[model samples]
Target: MGIPGGSAPSTRLLLLPGTLGAGLIGLSLWLGLSHGTPLRCFSGVAVGLCFVSAGIAAWRLRPRSRTGPWMALLGLVVLTSHLNDGLMLPTSMSGRELITLFGTPANWLQVPVAELLFLAYPSGRLRTTAERRLVTGAFALGAVAAMVMLATKTPVPICGGWCGPSPLQLVADPQLYLRLRSVFMTGTVVLAAAALALLIRRGIRSTPRQRRLLRLITLAAGLTVLLFAATQLFIVAVYTGRTGITPTVFLFETLTSWLAAITLPLAFLAGLLRQRLAFASVGTLVGRLEHVAANTVEAALAETLRDPTLRVAFPTEQGWIDVSGHLFHPPSDGSQLLTPLGDPPVAVLVHDPSLSEDRQLLDAAATAVRLSLENARLHAQVQAQLTEVRASRQRIATAADTERQRLERDLHDGAQQRLLGIGLTLGLLRNRVRGTTGRRLVDELERELCTAIGELRDLAHGIRPAVLTDQGLAPALAGLARRSGICVHLDVQVTERLDPLVEITAYYVVSEALQNIVKHADRADACVRAVHRAGWLVVEISDEGPGGATTASSSGLSGLADRVTAVGGQLQITSPPCGGTHLRAELPCA
Candidate 1:
């Protein structure tokens, strides 16, 4: 059956030669063993081995198989043929005896068939398409020659009817037959030589080791073909009656055949060894480079992570380094913090089984990064706690101010009103009694009540502004400006209303700054401007006064700054060389 799934054309072509070679070997073995020809038996064994080798090489497609087995089989055939001739089996055996035992119809067919089959094996290994076609054409021509010779010639009986010599020998004259055989042998030799030359040229252009192996194989193939040609020439010479076959020629053929057989296998083994060595060396080098690259990357990552303000990153396609992880620094205002290893930034995010996670001397930098991050987290938490505490204190201060305002209102409405009413009643009684002493006592009482009322009003104003609750921050600031006597210029531009607490806070800030200017600045004129800009209420107060004013030197201004800071607002004081004090406060409006 054909190979399954329709084998490659090359494989199909190779199979034909292999099958024919096997059939030849089987026939040769049967004839040699049955007829008791030791020379034939040995030739059969060698041919069998060659078939096996060629079959294996065809399957493997290894370079060495081209010459190795063919040379071996050719050597065995030459030796066996010569030995058979020397032994004179045909001359010694009686016709009846040879026919009954040694000579058989099968034996007659085996010899030429084996030789033809052997010739076809090398065709499969031809290098180029041209070479392959040439070799195939030669084999076809040889087959045609054999067929024509068989058709024209009559069979000549050798040892009775059991076996015979080639019919061509009987029909054609010896000279003409020898010339035909010489042409056949020469053509085959030339084809083989051409193939060998192509292989050698290919090898020469290859790597040094491969070239050496190929050259050796080519040499073996060439020598085998040369020896075969010499044997054919010697036979042709004998047929032509020029000279008898010489022992020296036979010896040379035998030696060269053996040499070809041994060299072929050696060449193949050498090439295999060279290929394995080269690949193994390459694998070792790649492994080392990979290890070095991994180590270098790890070290770099560790170094970057160890620094507080530094971050580790990976190169992007646009040649920018993207942050992969960071240590010690707070998250940037506009920029984001690096998360845990993901994507390109951290190349080796997955944990490797070979690597240790435990803290060690070699991993000190990585360990340091972990510690610093933890410390930074704890510091942030502590700051949050302090902020909460400050907020609690401010809440308490506001509550105390509310209580003071209530107390002041109670005194003004109850005790101070009651005293004024009593003084008025006393004045009316004295007028009814018509006494100067009573009137004088009533007037003194009235005067004391007035003083008490004035002190209570001052206390209420100090506790909290009635003006801030009655109107918005702008009107209160305007009232302050009107009262300041320092030519206070008010510019309030806040349109959207704010939280009561924020409005009060802004009012207080402006009031404190104006008071500072009046007390310390000694300025002739001052400007108070409050504008809402970029989600902040920006208040700027400037006075043309003697400079050199500082928050540290003035407790009130310093306290005002602290209060503003507590609410996440900034207060700046600038006293310039021109004897002007400028105070700027920015408070978040929302």
Candidate 2:
């Protein structure tokens, strides 16, 4: 039972029975017709027995079926017909006597009843019990009708001779006799034709193996109908006084009947062989589908296991191809399996062995899994790089802060203290000199020394504000606002102490913003506010200005933004329509 087109060992064995049956039919037909010795009758009987034997063997070999009994019945009928003809025909009559005997109702009935038995051969493999009973009943009815017609008949022309008394003449009712004959002949032809047509139509729509079985059954049925029809037509021609039973008609009827009788058993054998082949084909196809499905499952499993983000889906409940892998699952026995990919846990379903074979699909799935793993690895590397960059920026900010503090100390201890000492010496010199010229010179020198001390203090404050250390960010910003000669409001909402570096960064952002406002805002008042929210210190400095402030043109503000960002803070400047500018900074408090 291989696939119809596959090269399999069982196909060879399947062809053997049909071949042998055909050969046996051909050999038997040649021996029975070509030879004319007394042994010819024995040979015909032997050939008929062979046909019966083959049919019986075919029936027995098939599954327990109604077809088996039907075939067995057909074989028995053929054997009895041959045996009866052999024993009675030649022994009872010479050539002229045989021609005369053929006119008898019994002879006509025997031939038709035997022909009707051929119908059972093809349907012998797997018919239901009901169908078998119906067929048997039909055969019994046909046999009874033939017997009844034989029992009551009047003289009727048959092939230029007379069959007397013919059943129609003896019935004494011409209409009833015509009706019965017409009905019986028409029904048999119609039923046989319909059965053959249905078998052919079914074969055309079936798989190759089924087509073969149907072909055997249909061929058998067709031969039986052809032989029966020829016999009926000859009877009609002879009875209507249209033609004689010439040698040609006799030869044709004998040859056709013998061909049909021999082929019937072969047809049964062919049908049985076809059934075995069909079963084998189905098994093979099932195995192939299972193999394909297993491969798909393995591939999907490997991919999902390797990468959490990757998924696979099946489009049909059972088929060879998968339509979408991004979202699909295997069908569940009692639970719902079909769901979107984003659903929680994103379960991976196990494949059924019946649906597919698991081993063949693993390599491609493994490759996909590897690729998903690589993608995940690359993402982790990117995050690590970002963390490293952030740490580097923090280190740079710390170094910058240390350098600024050192410079502020150098200016305050070295430059500012020296300038103050020089101013004190100049003041003493002014006191010592009494003359107007000396006193004026000393006072001018003291005034110049005091101006130098003030400039140095301003420079030290710019490097690292003294007020930021002494009074915190809010007052330093407010003092700078006052120095700028702008009306400023300070709102300090944060009460918790922050990291020193964070405070410095916030103060610088405010100072730079206010300086920009005073130099370029061309407006009246400004407000500064600081608040702590969600572990961050937020500083907002707004001003009533001309309101076209831009970070791109303000280098000081841009530099302050960089410094704020270096300490892990953000700066935003919004200058809206009308006269207003807003600068906000958010810094981590921890």
Candidate 3:
């Protein structure tokens, strides 16, 4: 506060503004009473209180804001000048002369203070170079004009006190004083207006929290300017002998000017106090969260934290979802902060970005908001089950494959071999028999053995083909085509082997389509196509038949769809009345 790049306050202790304010008040009263000067002691205290309140808040809430002490200093300047105005004590000539110039120059100090308060406002630094330059220019013009007015007697009143002899009159000229006063007044008004405009502009552009801070100061500054303008107009009208300007109206306007001046510090203090209380009340908010409804948590958070943009979201098995159970994926934008409540983030709170740094507040609030966690835990359970379900499906597929392999092996090893041996034994016995009835019985037994062996081979192939295991998908698909009752044209472009699961799915896709076509399409010729493109193994089956086909909920096709989905793939069937039925499937390999 002492200088632009001054070190931040090291301690939260802020009795300085208070001490200075009390001293100023006591001095103002003593001077007003002892020297028979007009007393405005209460107004002085209000102005001083404005400074002290803001100063204390700024120092105590240093991490949150840095604009407080500046307010206090500006108050100090006004208080000292006010005391100087009514002090009629007999003192050193130079001291009295200094006070004479002090009034205008002191008020001039307010030009920069007002400019800075607006330029920095909630923050201590200017938002841009243009604003910094604006403050600089306003300070320069105000300083130079104050110097010019002090040095010479101008029509423009520089001192509010009665006793004054200009110390710089030997080197000063009235014409130059008048000219400088005009420039000063005009420039100060123009620059002050510009600063106010900037504050309003920034407020409009800010987020909800930032704009909240701006609103009070904007109102204060706006009223102060209006009162000043009214006072100036009334003064000009009186001095120019305008008859409509009455003393009562002039007094009213002058009093209103001070009110405007004091409003800024008061408004700022009120806002800071409210914010301080809000953060301190986090414990109370914990109880509120417990009783609050599902949709009301965000509003409660906004009220408790003084941030209206707060949002509560829960994590799902699929992704993140908001309170209404709609999917939400936060983007790379940095305007909002996301605070996670648990590992893998069961729940998340999205709020004003700067609030993220208030880790203690956020952590406590998240813990306190147990109701949201209850909902989050439910979602978490769902997510866990979804993961387990996918794993179970994979295990089920592997088990089905293993069972098919076992059955195929049993057919070959246990049943087929035994049947072949029995057939051979019957043929040898038929050659040895002399009687016609006995020989015919042996031949019939051999024929029955042959028929049983043929049936077992077909059944084994249906379970899991030996051709598929030995030759791969292309040839296996060709085998399925030959075995199908209806005419089929099989097309397979993948020369290299895919994963075991992919091959099995592709094989069965052809097998199932052919079976469906033969059974339902009534001898319609079918085209079965398998191709690997862009990290996907795609299978498509088309048939020219009277069609009204769909992936029915209870059909084998529904099970196939679930199987494809389990493997991170998809199945779709297309059929319409009089249109050919087309079944398409895609399984991801990458």
Best by lDDT: 3
Residue lDDT tens for model 1, 1-590 = 21111122365655555565555455556545655465645643563454345444533443223443343343334333323332234433344233322222222222332333233333224444655565566556556555544433322222233223442334544345455655655565565556555555655654442344456666666676667667666755664567775776656555554554455445545544544453344344434434433223333433332212233333323232323222224344522233333233332111211112111211333333333333333444454456557667667656755676577678767876886787678677767865788777767877887787778666666556677667777887888788776788889997767755566668777778788777876746888898987789888888888877778888887987877776667899998666788888888766
Residue 303 of model 2: what lDDT?
A: 32
The digit string of per-residue lDDT tens for model 3 on 1-590 reads 22112245555346667677778777667666655344455565566566666666555555455567777777777777665543443344335666556666776777687678766866566877778889989878877876776666433333334535455654445446545555566667778788888888877877888777777888877776666556555544544446354566535544653664566656656655654576567778876766776656667777777787787777766777666555667755876888888786768888886465355567766777765666545654555566667768877887888788888999999999999888888878987999999988887888888889999999998888887877888889987888787788878998887777778877877777777777777879999899998999999999988778777732878777887877778898888878978989998877
* Model 2 regions more than 4 Å off: 1-369, 577-579
- The lDDT of model 2 is 0.54
For candidate 3, the 10 contiguous residues with the lowest summed lDDT are 1-10
Compute the lDDT for candidate 1.
0.52
Least well predicted 10-residue stretch by lDDT in candidate 2: 353-362
Candidate 2, 494-515: lDDT as tens digits = 6666777888888788778777
Best of the candidates, TM-score:
3
* Prediction 3 TM-score vs. true: 0.55
- Taking all chains together, each candidate's TM-score versus the true structure is 0.38, 0.39, 0.55
Which parts of model 1 have CA positions greater than 4 angstroms off?
Answer: 1-369, 411-433
lDDT of each: 0.52, 0.54, 0.70
